[model samples]
Target: WSLGLKGERRDLAPVSTSYYRVQAPVSTYHHRVQAPVSTYHYRVQAPVSTSYYRVQAPVSTYHYRVQAPVSTYHYRVQAPVSTYHYRVQAPVSTYHYRVQAPVSTYHYRVQAPVSTYHNRVQAPLSTYHYRVQAPLSTYHYRVQAPLSTYHYRVQAPVSTYHYRVQAPVSTYHYRVQGPVSTYHYRVQGPVSTYHYRVQGPVSTYHYRVQGPVSTYHRVQAPVSTYHRVQGPVSTYHRVQGPVSTYHRVQGPVSTYHRVQGPVSTYHRVQGPVSTYHRVQGPVSTYHRVQGPVSTYHRVQGPVSTYHRVQGPVSTYHRVQGPVSTYHRVQVPVSTYHRVQGPVSTYHRVQALVSTYHRVQAPVSTYHRVQAPVSTYHRVQAPVSTYHRVQAPVSTYHRVQAPVSTYHRVQAPVSTYHRVKLRVDK
Candidate 1:
């Protein structure tokens, strides 16, 4: 602690040898209270020392305690100083409240019984004029309702889509059903026609014939031949003969009476027979001589005859004329004539010699009175003829009737159906 003295004092000189006794004490006082006020006090005691000190308070009072010494040094001299402090402390009390609610439930109710009885008593007054007005409180709530229009509209859109899909399926089913039966029937018809179309074969035949003829002829004819002949007649003769005659009767020629021989016959019928009685006398009455007789009647000449009669009577020469007789002569006949073929001669005889020389004539013989005849003969033959001929032929044929058969078969058919669905909401 330091104290400043206001009164004059004297310093002691270095050479003075006197002992100085300085006693310094300083005291500082700090006071603080609950009122948050601070007070400070300083007190000094001299011989005089230097001192420094401070005090502070922010919200409330505080007590600060210090115990320390002051030190001073001069030219090697050291001084020791003393410090003092005084504190005044006032008692202070502080209060603080803190409350926190817990996780449990709590309820508090308070009712006074006097009020309850008074309230029950008022309810028993039925005829009492009681005007009660309750405040009009309206509560408005907003409720959202699900409308059927939205669901119906959704169903409508789905229905149109379903139709779009079903259209193609229905069309396809119709196409499948339309021509199936017709096509099968057409195919069966063509098959039947083919089955009925069968074929047959051809045919052939032949024949022939023939004929012939002939002829003949005839003829007639006549023929004849005849011939005749006549024989030739001619006469021829030559004769040589003798003829004699005697005549003259002598009277009473020769009577001889003397004869003795027998006389056979004598007859004198008439005439005067003079009997000559001179029988023996020579008779000389008369005698005559004649020539020799000629055989042919043609006398050429007389023959001389000499007779010897010697008696001559009256000498008378009786001369007789030549007497002649006629005689017929025979003639020779010839007959031989014949002719053949076509030759003929006709003869006419006025005077014919009627003599036939042969009994049976030759090819031509005849009497002496007619001409010869001729004969002829003729002959003929028969005839014949012939010819040739030909003829024609023919043929025919027939064909068999056609035959056929038919048959049919069925084909497989298929059907299809589409699936459909309906929804109700």
Candidate 2:
């Protein structure tokens, strides 16, 4: 084994001994020697037996010895053989340290040995002589002793702490710290004081107060908030103008002038021929005009000339003296006179011859002839003639005319012979 006495340390080196043992005390110190100071890191090769040696000032040691399940190293403050004998036994295969200091107005802390698999702790103060042992299966603790005051805190995975004391000017406070699933604290003080503090799974519980608490207050959780905004916009408009007008036209057109005077001709001696023209109006029409005529006759007349001629004839007259002849003239009183004489006497042959002679006057006439003429004759001329001639002859002629002249004469004769001659040339 080795020993190190330094004012400050940076690292700890391992000191190994396999079965090397010793029978006396190992002492290593560093001091100013004019005043009291501390000692550090004294290691031993074996256990010691001496008890009466003294260091003239207070001492402090820090030692660590680690190995397997047989022996362990610890820091212990053993009193001098003249005061008391100390026997400390520790678990094997773990490292432990013990330190003790003299009476002074300073802070003192002690921690119990921790086992490797399951760590159990016992903490005691010098004057209070209170010893606590709890199975804090893998936990850590700190023990503190001040002048006339003591405090300790235990942090275990699943454990409890019950601390009770009856002192007027002394206070004991213990904390049992672990995961909140299985950790609780209970403290009982002098005057019927009991308090329990638990955390997790039940955040709020009830408590009974025998007396008034000096200060009581509570805190609350937090709250949240939000905000909103907006964006852009638009607009529109309309416009317009005015109105107008127009004109139209239609079909065909024609024009005519006025005409006057006489424009036509008639024979070679031209008559006054009036001029003709068409006159126009909304509906009617017009034209021109003329006159009438005459005649003549003729008449005719005719006149004729007539001529007459005369012829001579002779007759014998019986003029015998009336008395001589009458004597025997049985001349037949002819049947003409119807005489009744005896017929026998008349037959006496009286032959008598009578001759008659007649003389006629001579007539001489001169005739004047007249004829008619026409100036304008449309007819022919007509002429008529009448002629009558009578002479005693044996031939007789009869003429019947439209103009006739009649004459009568009486004559009686018994027998006569007469010759008449008539010539018509």
Candidate 3:
């Protein structure tokens, strides 16, 4: 029936097909549509099918897969994966992977973490360990880590410190005042200069002995030696001895007597007696025994007993018996004496007369007279008796009066007439 059927086939039924037999049948499909789709699609579908298929995903995933592909695949499929099973199954893969660590911002902190210790910072690639000592000291430590041994140089802490030490310099000084006698010292350091001043060697006063003194008199006397201390301090001394003395006289007539002293004695005696006369200047007079009146006697008459005597004169008379006389006479100009024979009643008489003298015999009995005359008279008469006869005459112009007569008469009686006359011329 090839007639026109109305088509309403809405059923879930099988439909039959018509085939045409062609003259030539192609053995392989040869066209762009027949190649099993491209290798890109297969590669994209590779992850969905196999139990161990790996996807060629991004390079990161690829790298992961290549490292642990089985484990990652099993894990993503949510299978019962054990850590030991994956670990046993995984290959000992060697990978040259470089892991970049965090970038190091090298920094340091400057701090005195403790008041007693010092802080220091070192160079790069250096490390250090610090220890704080209780007594404010610092200790350094080197870090020997597993990787490397780091070298560390530590500096002392910055802080204030104190210590007990000697002063910087040494010095010395000296001083002096007024009068200094001696100063002795030992110097320790270098000397600069020396100065000195002298005050006084003031004079000292003392005493000494000089010379011995002496004193003397006008006489030749020994001087006494004594010391006289004059000026300042002195003394005196006296000699121990006796001194001699002398005398001084006035004229030639000198009378000397012995004088006694403390040490010496003296004596006095009479010297020879001397005499002088008016005529002779000095005469040696002989000693005689004469009366003081006999030295001056004069004769007056010319008779045998009339005489004058000058210095000292004396006479002796010897006569015969009865009517005799004796006379001794010395005169200035002349003198006379009579010597008569033994009388048969006659007499012998010696007469001395000076100057003018006269004598006469009695005119009756036998008698005689001897006489002389001169200008001046000197006579000596004896104590005898004479006869009264005639008185004699005057014989001189200027005459001295005769001596007054005092008689001692002894005569025999032969009387005669006698005339006594007195004459003046």
TM-score of each candidate structure, all chains considered together: 0.08, 0.12, 0.12
Tens digits of per-residue lDDT, candidate 1, 197-296, equal 0011101110010000001100011101111101111111111211111212212112111111111111111111111111111222111112111111
Poorest stretch of ten by lDDT in candidate 1: 205-214
Best by TM-score: 3
lDDT of 1 at 331: 17
Off by over 4 Å in 1: 1-240, 245-298, 316-425
For candidate 3, what is the TM-score? 0.12
201-289 per-residue lDDT for model 2 (tens digits): 10111111111111111101111111010111011101011101110101111121111111111111011111111111111111110
Model 2 residue 411 lDDT score: 27
Over 4 Å off in model 3, which ranges?
1-308, 318-392, 395-406, 410-422
lDDT of 3: 0.17
* Per-residue alpha-carbon lDDT of candidate 3 for residues 120-225, written as tens digits (9 for 90 to 100): 2111111111111111111111111110111112111111111111111111111101111111111111111110110111111111101111111111111111
Candidate 2, pairs of clashing residues = 75-97, 75-98, 315-356, 316-355, 316-356, 317-355, 317-356, 392-420
Better of 1 and 3 by lDDT: 3
